[model samples]
Target: MSFIHLDRPDCPEAHRPEAHHPDRKLTARKLITRTGSSPPVHCGHVAMVTRVTKNMSAKAKQSNKSADKNANDRNDVASKESDAEKANPQWKLISHEQINTLLDLTVEQVQFQFEEILGLKNYQTCLKEASLLDYFVSGFWWTREMNYTCQQISFIMALLQFLLDNISEKQMPFVDNLNEFAKMISGTRQSPSPEVDSLFDAEQAMSITDYLKCSLFQNYQLYEFLFSQPREELLLGKKVRLPASLCPYVC
Candidate 1:
């Protein structure tokens, strides 16, 4: 058999290079030589991987920012608690700091100076009034529970204000529906942080209930008897006589 030479006219294609197809632009990257990894990498794949990595990094940064914010908030609360505690030992009972926005007297401080009302004993009129400090101490000890809302704090402050305001009154305001108040207090419990959509997130209700039971509710009848408007001394045991002026309720 005669050998076929590559340069022969009949063997023209054997020595010539392959021609490029018109569709090579579209499929150019689809074909590649095996290099060190024996796998092909395309520009599109590289871009896709870069985008995914960038997204993941951004998410990680957001997560870190949230964590840092929570941490800073916790630290701020701790600082406030420390400052409050230093100002008054009674603040020790508070489990957490509260946001008292309505009235500055609720949590920020007392209206009556401590040195004037709760601090001195020798200057106290009615020797029994000296024990007011003890009353506050015991009450605070009973109700130190804190909450996110201002309900419990405001209620406590209101009660204290009423007590102080009507200390010398013939009759202090009395709850006509003690049972209803009790029911409201005993209504519901909640997590420290319930859903925003909740209608009855009243964890402080029970806290107030326990507090009143421990401090105020137990002395309900005593408060009415000691502070409420008494019948006229001349009409006592005979006929009832109303007070000259009634308590201003709307104010």
Candidate 2:
């Protein structure tokens, strides 16, 4: 029989003995109601909380990313500034140590390039010509970077003159040919004059020469000391003064 038919008072009820339990029926209804209500309300609250947390987390991540990008941009700017400073060297403002280091490195590179070009036939013939130009150009650039210091311009001129003279007056025949090498090939092969070619005024040349002399003296004190000493002491004319302590090891 169908459940509706059996539940009719007129028909014999199926499981009539169990139908009288009121507490169980009430408990079962309460459990069904709670189970249905719990899932939707609890699930909705949980979903809302999860979405809020996700939004906050995503916002924090975006903020961190932006901060990282800004930091990278700042670093890039700082690096560029440093590179510019290096490329445009401030010769006048640089410290002595920095100048010395720069000079050593540049001279080494120049020497290497000169040696490499020395073997080439045309370079061997005209190497001095190119080198003469190189020296003047390097000085020009140095002066340009130094805010066109008249003193520096003069120093370079005097220094070049001294180098030319010393190289021409050196020992050996090959060194003597350097004088010919310094000749102006472009303008009728005349002997090169550091003073004449230089743009510095006469007064400026004097100042530059004085400064260059001082600098050379400071750098080559040992050379000066050695060269100035007399080979023949003339022991008979001047008696040597004995040291306070009679040790032969006395300096």
lDDT of each: 0.47, 0.46
Candidate 1 residue lDDT tens string, 24-74: 343333334313233457889999999999999999999999999999999
Q: Would you give me the overall lDDT of model 1?
A: 0.47
Off by over 4 Å in 1: 1-127, 145-155, 163-201, 225-251
Best by lDDT: 1
After TM-score superposition, the amount by which residue 32's alpha carbon in candidate 2 deviates from its true location, in angstroms, is 9.7
Q: What are the per-model numbers of colliding residue pairs?
A: 5, 0
* Residue pairs with backbone atoms closer than 3 Å in model 2 (clashes): none
